[model samples]
Target: GRLLNALAATGNEKYLEGFGPPAPGYKHAPLNNTNVVRDMVDDETAGILVEPIQGEGGIRATTTQFLKDLRAICDEFGLLLFYDEIHTGFGRTGKMWGYEWSGVKPDVAAIAKGMGGGFPIGAFMATEKAAVGMVPGTHGSTYGGNPLATGVANAVLDELLKPGFIDDVAKKGEYLKGQLEGLVKRHPSVYTEQRGMGFLQGIQCAPAVPAGDMVNRLQSLGMLVPPAGENVVRIFPALIADKAALDEGIDILGKAAQSFEAAKAAE
Candidate 1:
């Protein structure tokens, strides 16, 4: 839950002002700042939307207090609270929902990514009370209700909810976290620290090493993971991944880190 205040993905409205003029009235609280959210609420404010675990923003965890405070603020203001759980949904975190750690239920939530099981599918859910305004024609998608997509999503959801599935994911995640932390300790010249929950995790590369360079090094060693903004290499593994698989990834990371350290020292 070390949510630091960082800008959003580049070119976003709040991120460098979308590389142009800003939107008329859009506003955002620094990632972990509670005051911004509080001050921004008013008659024109709709609600608050956020990612419990920021995947692209360096796998930053949302503090339990921060999430709970948002919930309380929304309730007090008679406003909706929404969650964009696409990245952290479906057991990416130890919990089924990133907000579940705080036990705050959102009025509306959007989910996708892992839910599709490699297919293209997405869904938005609103509590019965919050859904009253989202009538049939109010909002819909061209591919939203496809039978095949729904079928695949259902199968994926069923597997994720099966007994002991998420528990195993949590166990694997702890193991993986140890592996990443080990890299940080043993290869400090390359990675400064490890952060994240479950299979969704990241390691911050040192200033001397570029995250993209580390990513290429890992890929060359037979592991593939994307780079998160602000020089982070995300450690995203399959939900059903095992020790051997994670060990392979860690081994690759170790080799890559050593290589980067050696290169840095040479420089």
Candidate 2:
């Protein structure tokens, strides 16, 4: 489908194989390592595009120090910093936006997904200066400005911005995280410590059990977790999910892990 590959640009090997090399204007930086960022960027570089918390590339996060360093480096090098918060926005990361945790603002931000409250809409924001080149009448879309989409989006924003809505998301994320950590302790063979913040988390599995295998098992248990790089089973829970529901989901995943272990032992 067009939607499946529209988000298609990555330095990942699988992407390289499928898409035949990355686009010309991009550079790859190790998630939390700014040295690689410095080494790869040069005078010709226009800006840096980063994800505050990686989703499909695995549940990786950038350290606050690294994010701060990027801000400083981008300033020194005069590069615009863009954040792809498509997955981390709208309370997915417990924070209104994942970059908020580092206290570093992006010059431009791409956001979507949960922002629609089940409807489909995505938008990119830029600081006034950064947006100067985007003349008002030059850029326009047909379906993009449709009243129905815009109205639903506006209503969704009202709910997301309501007092204590974001706070509850952060607290629920903590609860879910604590439960996942317990699973790691109980089944060290099948799992590793959780990766990710808030409601977006992943369970790293050992090579003995592939992440795809766990994804299959979890599907059977009524959970539809996705797989990420380095053998990770990702769980992206709804922002409004409560502690009880999160616990039940995690419990089902734990049982799935145990079942996988037993099946492996029998082999």
Candidate 3:
């Protein structure tokens, strides 16, 4: 947690107050800016870690060119490139892996969340060269690689790898994006923009519409959208949801916005 706090640029300071300082040497840079990252790297740097699409940080996505530049920078500096794919793995982003969007593979990747299809399991994968130091005894956990978790993960993969499954996700995601854009246009007083990819989407609230208020309003109306940083409301539907389900969600979201606008007018 401390290390994550150090690596994160926002929304981590409160949790780190009582904890001693986070591990040293980790540096942070603005998202999608390769030049800032290049300037921060030096002889002491060992690796670079990033999320292809930030989940809690308002669902911001890294540009393809920025990812490519990071790959090239890692090669030039002899540093390992790492990806935190916990939120974007297992077809969440309409791809088997989020890094697929950039075509720049990471030397190491941390994956979890959807890997076990609701089962509690997490793992880190590395290339053969990057994993040279991980011998049999070097790393072990009481429940790591247990048969049940691995079995569940394999079954999940089997379903995810089925023909047309990922493509359907992509198609539905585009449809959802278009609907969200329409929602923003219709409710200009409540929402300013929509962001993110695939099932992971965020609706940025207008300055007068607090994300927390919108989340509560949606929940009261039989919906549950979470609040994210920068006054964005996160909307992650189940991967198996069909167009009908998505339409229902969008309808509820629109109603919530309409209610907010009504209240504002009355005020």
Candidate 4:
């Protein structure tokens, strides 16, 4: 628990205030930098934890080479590789796991959110060797394995695993990304670019257009695009959204960007 808090501290100094001293074993490295990661590791290092696709950090996705390098580094140093797949797991990325895209597996992975299908549940899966020390009584939570939650997760999995469901998600993601790219080109004054994959997309607002302003504008247009770090507006659609729904959302997004561009020109 303290370790997780310590890890949080590495993300922001404010996280450590009133939380007492952070545990000393963790280190933070820039995303996609293999050199810094390797340099940071040593005899005291136990593992590396990362989000395959950073959600709150502005929808930044790790490169395939970066993940592969992380795995290689972990293996060379006899350390574990952990993935925080809370956002990118369970078909959000058009794959069962975001790490699947890189073909690099983690020794342990923390997954939740979509897995529960709106139910409250979170879990960590470990490899055989990683789980050796995790026998009964080693670790757990009060509501760790609630039957109702597990049942709901199973029901959700049934739909996600159906033939062509994930493939269709991939197809839809490409379509969404293309449309967003076109939006960026059409309103360069409002949006600089688009980031992310699958249903977890983001449009980065230009410096002249704050992400919060765009989010508010979209919300008023009957669409909800949440703002993320680095002036990004996240466009996470429901997995079940069809082409018509996506087109409608894209149209609304274009409208929002156009409105911002128009307001800027008016000034």
User: TM-scores of all models?
Assistant: 0.91, 0.93, 0.95, 0.94
Candidate 1: list runs displaced more than 4 Å: 1-24
The weakest ten consecutive residues by lDDT in model 3 span 1-10
Point out where model 2 deviates above 4 Å.
1-9, 16-18
List model 2 lDDT by residue over 31-90, tens digit each.
Answer: 888888899887798888888988878888888998899899889998999898988998
**lDDT-superior candidate, 1 or 2:** 2
Steric clash pairs (candidate 1): none
**How does residue 207 of candidate 1 score in lDDT?**
86
Number of the candidate with higher TM-score, 1 or 3 = 3
214 Cα displacement, candidate 4 (Å): 1.3
The TM-score, computed over Cα atoms with residue i paired to residue i, of candidate 3 is 0.95
- Backbone clash pairs for candidate 2 read none
User: Per-residue lDDT tens digits of candidate 4, residues 61-178?
Assistant: 9999999999999999999999999899999999989999999999999888999989999889999998889889888888989999999999999999999999889999999999
* Whole-structure CA lDDT of model 3: 0.89
lDDT of 1 by residue, 129-202 (tens): 99988777787777779999999999998999999999899899999999889888898888998989899899
Would you list the C-alpha lDDT of every candidate in the order shown?
A: 0.83, 0.84, 0.89, 0.89
Residue 116 C-alpha lDDT in model 3? 93
For model 2 the local lDDT of residue 52 reads 91
Task: Give the per-residue lDDT digits (tens) of candidate 3, residues 90-109.
Answer: 89888989999889999999
